[model samples]
Target: MSATDLSASPSAPARSRTVVASLRLLRSELRIIAGRRRNQAGILVLASVPVLIAVALKFSQPREGRGPDFISSATSNGIFVSLTALSIEIALFLPLAVAALAGDTIAGEANIGTLRYLLTVPVDRTRLLAVKFVSLVLGACFGVLVVAVTGVIVGGALFGLGPTTLLSGSQIGLADALARLALAVLYLSAGLAGLAAIGLFISTLTEQPIGAMIAITVVSTAMWILDGIPQLEWLQPWLLVHYWTAFSDAFRDPIFYEQMRQGLLVALGYVVVFVSLAWARFTQKDITS
Candidate 1:
């Protein structure tokens, strides 16, 4: 073989090795995340939200202004129960679940003294961070899916399943409504991705997992508070949580896209900025733990 051919042959194997190693690292990270008792508890709690909503709605009639408009109609059609539960939890519990998972992606391992050991492996630091991040994002998505799936099951049982009425006073088939629910779940999951990125960035800054969790939770609360203040209206558009409720737009007759589009753009911006920050810090930071 020529010198160029010999050099290129080695490069190909090196790249293949890197890919295999990265996949192994991701699998390990996912297993560790799945085995954690706290993550399991979080998933259980998220799943319970829909059950609670269904039970409560089944037992009582919704009062005006008591909850989302959809709740008033949830008893008539089961799918609305899922949407109502989502609306209730998306503001807090959903994000909290995301925070719980992403907040510990790095700091939790470091606190347990496993981070150093993992870094000592053949894994590249950048690749390691990428795996942790992808795992955390998947974990967050799983949390949302848990809520959506449980909501569907519990809601369908408590209330009869049938066609759904759109927010625009139009009716859609049961299949179409389920499809929209899936899209709404995707939107909500994407919304939480921004928060997960922020949580991952915070996780890199501390050795205590609880500290990272609390810090991100506090940041979420602060944004929520600010978003609620009229005087802070000027800052609402810039806040990460500002357009979270825009997922409701998915249920519109024509499927309103403006708010969801804006929400998605803002979410993507946050993810890019915070994930970049995490990569930069993790690459340079000295891992003593």
Candidate 2:
């Protein structure tokens, strides 16, 4: 991103207001996202989960668990540690972290009485919304990357960076394994992207960031609950979380794309719908703050 236009540019040229100003706004949004103490703590917590998982499995024998079979293979190949940590954290921590940041995107500014001033600038509400959503998406990806990186480091020390055993019992070199792990991270981040969009829409509806965060969390939890209900089997296919666990399919030798494709489509659907709704609401909203 280009350097932020530090000086207020209420009268900046329309040429600069094109992509350059948008980039500057995006840069500032990212900086604000990274600089918040709460965001810092949330990221630290995300990094800790993988470390804790790797460290726990190191001292103790692998135990059969309800999660992905990767948990047992952590001792066999450290790469599995990242997969296991991701599978576990994606259930709660990742979503919560995303919710917190997404909830803060617009509501936080409004709560702080800066939103009105922001609108006073040359930037349009649409551009501001776009930048906020992008920052939130990047933040989601960063949260996932932190867990994967932390798991790789700790797991590598505890176990050799050996071949990754696929679900089919075939093995691939460490490099190939890392690539698959990166795919898993990207897939998971895409799933969280939908949640972030939901939070963005909710954030536009409230000044209380906490309320928006809680609403986003509840929406996620409800979808999971609906997915788990056997009576809702027909409905599960449309749920945002239904294919989240499909990242495990990436570990298969042939690499299944059916569920992954469906997951991405679901995420895209949610993002489009909710982001549109947010734009509609925000553009018409009166910003007193």
Model 1 bad stretches (over 4 Å): 1-13, 62-66
Give RMSD (Å) of candidate 1 vs. truth: 2.7
In order, the Cα lDDT scores of the candidates are 0.86, 0.89
Per residue, candidate 1 scores C-alpha lDDT tens digits across 169-213 of 989998899899899989988888899989999999989988998
Instruction: Put down candidate 2 lDDT per residue, 157-256, tens digits, no spaces.
Output: 8987888888899989988889888999999999999999999999999999999999999999899889889998999999999999998888898899
lDDT of candidate model 2 versus the reference = 0.89
Q: Which window of ten consecutive residues has the lowest lDDT sum in model 2?
A: 1-10
lDDT (C-alpha) at residue 123 in model 2: 64
Model number with the top lDDT: 2
User: Per-prediction TM-score, please?
Assistant: 0.93, 0.93
